[model samples]
Target chain A: MTLLECKNISKKYGEKEILKNINLSLPSDKIIGLLGKNGAGKSTLIKLINDLLTPTEGEITVKGKPIGVESKRSIAYLPERTYLDKRMTVQAVLTYFSDFYDNFDRQKAEKLLAALDLDPKERLLKMSKGMQEKVQLVLVMSRKADMYILDEPLGGVDPATRDYILNTILSNFAQGASVLISTHLISDVERILDEVIFIDKGQVVLQESADELRTREGGSVDEIFRRMFRC
Target chain B: MDFVFDNNIPIYIQLVEQLKTYIVSGALAAGERLPSVRELAMMTKVNPNTVQKALGELENLGLIYTERTNGKFVSCDSEKIYALRLEYAKNISAEYLAGMKKLGFSAEQAVIYLEDLGGEDFDTSGM
Candidate 1:
């Protein structure tokens, strides 16, 4: 079944159109990479799906219904910026997520926290930038949602920690649920992606299976992206 | 136990090859239950669908079998495994000879070089 579909979606901010007539359908039970360069309106599309921003001239749907509170219930969203409360301890944050999201899994979150070696007593303000990012990702992934939308989950981190984040994202998702991850670091997360959507200037230039793309292009996904979007 | 994919080759093909390697190398013994698709995906850091496709190919090749309500298991027939090992050795030998030929070495010269490098450890295998 289709997990999400955007039909002729367009976004405009005071006459400056960020997205054109975009039509895309994301299927269930797959990990899709949303790839784009900076200022290419990748974030605009993600925000539309998450229902954080309204579309200008089109409609978006999740699981055959319009994106609304019900769609939001089924989608776990992790934005590009940090939104955690700086004064909350790790344990307190866990409680906050559990209280806010009925679908949140406390035990799973605790296990992930332990795997990342994050102390439950440590305050969010004391954690380094990288640690904070990981914590935020853990909170988002610990929910039993039908779809996961992560914006720049791999942005600005060391290579070692990047692998850890990818592993966490892959292992934590429930079976048959879809994950839409927006990222510019193609090579770093290419292995885990089933499909890739290449957005350029608010339009989807290409959407293809990762393996098929590699075979047809005769190069890594990152290499293909560089050739396609080279300055 | 390590899956080092170069990411250029098709991932499912690489996965099938790696699982076959594990089976023939005895790293995954005959009749051993294959890890669940999710577990294998976690270990390899790829989509579960990719791993599922690889496992399906292995089943087609008679390298593994799935028992309903149970799980996937490596083929228990040792003769079948031995045949696979022999075929693998033949492919490796052909490639090795071709590489040596490029370096201006005949079969006899290749043997001599192996002997000079103390080829005693290779005696037990079918060289």
Candidate 2:
């Protein structure tokens, strides 16, 4: 089933075009890697999907309905920057999510916390950056949402923690839920992705199945990316 | 337990194939506990999610089964490994042949090349 659709979507920031006539249809059972260089509108595209920002032109829909607060409820978003208040403890974060998202699975959140060896009472402000990232992921993935839009999820974690974060993302979620992961670090998360969408200069250059692209291109996604974006 | 992951190939696919080899070779014995996802991640220095994906693929194929309290374990059915190996081999052979054909090797030339490489004498008994 098509979980999300963006049709001829365009966005502008102070007369500078960030997204140009974007069109995408996301299936419910795939993990999509959104690839782009810096300032390629990857973040802007995500915001449009989540309805955090409206398109200057065109339209988007979630399950055939227009983008709105109701659509946001079915989507779990992890932005590039830290969104949690640093003073809140792990337990408090869980409580906050539970209050906001009805589908928040407390048991899953607790399980993830236990696995990560994170104490619920520990304040976010006191934890290291890597630990805080984990906490954010835990809260995000604990939701039983139809779509997950994670932007730059692995931007700054240590190598050791990055693996755990990835594993938690894979193992924690239910089947058939679509995940849209946006990042320039393609090699790290390439294994779990079923499809990829390459964006450049506010335009989508390509979108294809991961396996098909690899077979046809005769190299890794990173290599293909390098060739396409080479100066 | 050792593998060289090609950037072109997905990490989970490499892990799945490598684990299959281990199973077929009996290196990872039936009923043996596989490494925790984190442990494998730390060992490979890859993302834990990559390791989890590999493990998840194995579980889906019935080559590995998870025991909730004890973690993931190798399947007791040894034949399953060989079945998986056969399937993997067929896929590799098809891709290899297609690649060779694309490189201008005729069917006859490819077979002759395989024969000259002593491919016929190689053991196919395992599968």
- Tens-place lDDT digits, model 1, residues A1-231: 899999999999998999999999999999999999999999889999988899998999999999999998899999999777799999999999999999999999999899888789999999888899899999999999999999998888888889889999988898789999999998888899899999999999999999999999988999999999999
The pairs that clash in candidate 2 are: A163-B47, A163-B48, A166-B49, A167-B49
Assess each prediction's global lDDT (C-alpha) against the native: 0.92, 0.84
TM-score of 1: 0.95
| lDDT, candidate 1, B37-124, per-residue tens | 9999999998899999999999999999999979999999889999999999999988988998898777876776677674555342
Top TM-score: which candidate number? 1
Q: DockQ for the candidate 1 complex?
A: 0.70
Q: Categorize the docking of model 2.
A: incorrect
Interface RMSD of each: 0.8, 4.7
Off by over 4 Å in 1: B118-127
Task: Tell me how many residue pairs clash in candidate 1.
Answer: 0
Candidate 2's DockQ: 0.18
Residues A31-110, candidate 2: write the lDDT tens digits: 78999999899999998898878899999999999999889889999988876888999889889999999989999889
